[model samples]
Target: MPALPRARLLVAATAAAVGLGLATPAHAAPETIVREEARTAEVVAEAMALAEQLAERQQTLAVLNRRADARDRALIGYRAVLSRYGYDGDPDTARAVLPLASYDLSAGFGLTGPLWEAEHGGQDFSAYAGEPLVAVADGVVTEVADAGPYGLRTILTLSDGTEVWYCHQTDATVVVGQEVAIADVIGSVGSTGNSTGPHLHLEVRPAAGDPVDPMDWMRAQGLDP
Candidate 1:
């Protein structure tokens, strides 16, 4: 190569220096680097705070769900108890119900049995001793006393002036004037009067008069024995 002119050589050297300056990156100042780091830290802190809030909300929702489940279980248990007594939610639409949950028809009314002096005046329901006895219909307790052969008895007068007698009970739970709804537990079954095993002697009387067939009366009230 031939030697270049001085002015041209100087101009070429200046152009090369300018190109090197454009290609290489400049070093950042210490204060600028620190500011960039602080900005990054701020962004990270905001993300962490949002994550914590979401976790707390999730925990709160879980607790609420647990409480709702517990309440549902309690309601189911309460409904089960009511169903056992034949209460179908609305009491006004319900007619009559069975006096006991489980029982078998034994000696019926007008049947001649050796356990009775004359013909049987009431229907007999064979059941276990100490079984809960419920009211057959809505009525007010008119009498609670012990008779000669009827044992511990309770007389409930219905709304239509019909009287129902619950005999052979272990004890009476109502007073003389307490109102009772259908399926209300009035007493328990027992052999209190005449000689017999655990049973209930149910009697029906119109206007508190002569005894009648309890099975037929219950059927009239839209219930089977």
Candidate 2:
């Protein structure tokens, strides 16, 4: 009977050991699953951040493309205007040229200042005294005389009957009714009449009417100045 009790104790100890072994593996499985989930979440977060950065870059590129398209359209429109004015022979000479080889823009049209009784009607090209001035387009000399406030001036009439005034000139090279082409030396800069400094005061009058902004007219002719 004592041997039977000892065998019963041995069997009970073996069974208890097996149960502890199974419980250990079950507890460890939950910890392993939590570590895997954390790694997956980290990978997903990194991917989301990279995707947001890519979207922002694409938006910036889209804005740049829009601005490029706008500039291209403006260039095309100005080129068309030049072609309509019969300047389409050579691409190099297709646009109207500047009157002076080197000069600075000093004043603008429609400005309110003490120097004028009314709003200023012309654009001023500031340069040294006796700087050579040239014709801006193909035209005939309409007037070349001394005016009270304009000093000595030269006027050229365009094919469209538009008059371009070259004011504050020391002297004029072209006479009345003489045809002049673009860039022909027409006068020299001065500070005569109601003047301040040596500058060419340029004016544009469409159809011999009131003066308009010469800068705007020059831009419409595909010329920047």
Candidate 3:
């Protein structure tokens, strides 16, 4: 009989260790290992099915990312083109896959427009009063801490590599790794840290930790400061 392929031989041996009794290579008949190959094939097939399932999930994520990019463009009014990799231009406005609601999102509270504001890569915003706050997007609560002028803050990281930080909060809504939704309350606005008054301080950060102008993003969603 032809010799067994080295790859198949290794797989059969491992399968035997996991289930069937393993035999020494000194066994007389090559048929002994060939029988084990069929069992190993079943394992490989199961792995393929699992991979297919993961691929489908990736496709869903791609759609969501596309929508996010469109939302960004609308808010900032920038004609910046985006790759179709993660956009899903869903037109439904009923509820956001992740959304933000009224919770004292006031204006005049940053560097550019407000009396006091924070800086990110040379960008600024208006400063204003801080108060009760909540989640702006659906995601896991990744951070809850203080940033001198920003006050108590909570960061919610969405599945699509977008991070939302609710700053100038009086208190935090959730701890690290906690799952939160767009409709759920997370915290309140306050001047606990480095803030001046009681207004919500919001920032949108990339997964790599770069902060962008959330003003442009919020406007894209048709929200006013």
Candidate 4:
């Protein structure tokens, strides 16, 4: 039994000088003493908060692409085809302004329209039962069908000679020549043709055989429509 003590001989010569690899008191504390200008100012404030959240998501996608390009230029119409009313004399009078059709009738009218009140002689909610139909101007379709109570129809044809009937429709997408643009849906909202409930029996000729008087052309387009 020998003696050792002196703090266990200075703790075994500081663990044999940290097993000969030398540096010890927990490697004397120096991991680059946390500097480099405070880690480059916290990496430039996290790259300026990720460039201000990518400039507020590029200004909310440029205001939702300018409101979907102003509702696709209000369903394809601005000017061209100004109210004719011809019965096929073929004069080529040039005019095609579109965007008229759009009635809520507070929410009445659908199928072939005119519900009681002496057949819409009172003009209640006037139009719409299922409402999707949209192709006011750049058209071509020509005519699609449905039968069974006119449950669907199309008949586009616009280039100035007008004629854009699109009644009832529960689904028609488009067919004939198939050009379509303004409101482009071309079919939806249905009570099907001769309906009693759902609605959208639009009709407007103004030329190539006139029918003119869709609520005085939807109040000449300023639209209470």
TM-scores, one per candidate: 0.62, 0.59, 0.46, 0.23
lDDT for residue 132 in candidate 4, whole number 0-100: 43
Give lDDT per model, in order: 0.69, 0.69, 0.49, 0.48
List residue ranges in candidate 3 displaced over 4 A: 1-131, 222-225
Work out how many backbone clashes candidate 4 has.
Answer: 18
**TM-score for predicted model 2 compared with the true structure:** 0.59
- For model 4, residues 1-225, the per-residue Cα lDDT tens digits are 011123432443444444544432443346543453355445445544554453344334434543554575567443311221111122242223323244454432232444433233112223444334456556688777764344466778777776767665555656888787644556544554345555565666766475555556555643335
Evaluate residue 189 in candidate 3 and report its C-alpha lDDT on the 0 to 100 scale: 42
lDDT of 3: 0.49
The 10-residue segment of model 4 with minimum total lDDT is 80-89
Q: Which window of ten consecutive residues has the lowest lDDT sum in model 1?
A: 1-10
Displacement of the residue 54 alpha carbon in candidate 2, Å: 68
What are the root-mean-square deviations of the candidates from the true structure over C-alphas? 37.6, 33.9, 20.8, 29.6
Task: Write candidate 2's Cα lDDT for 1-225 as tens digits.
Answer: 001123332333344444444223444577775775465455545544554453344334434543553465477764443443334456456536677756889989999899987899899989866666777888999998876588778899988999999897766668999999776667667665577777889999999999999888988986666
- Residue-wise lDDT of candidate 1 within 76-167, one digit each (tens)? 76344345554455555777777776788898899886788998998999986566777888899998887657877889999999899988
Report residue 118 deviation for candidate 3 (angstroms). Answer: 6.7
Cα lDDT for residue 75, model 4?
72
The order by descending lDDT is 1, 2, 3, 4
Candidate 3 lDDT, 39-124, residue by residue in tens: 55666566445544533443344345435544765775311211111123433331222223224334532345345443332122
Among these predicted structures, which one has the highest lDDT? 1
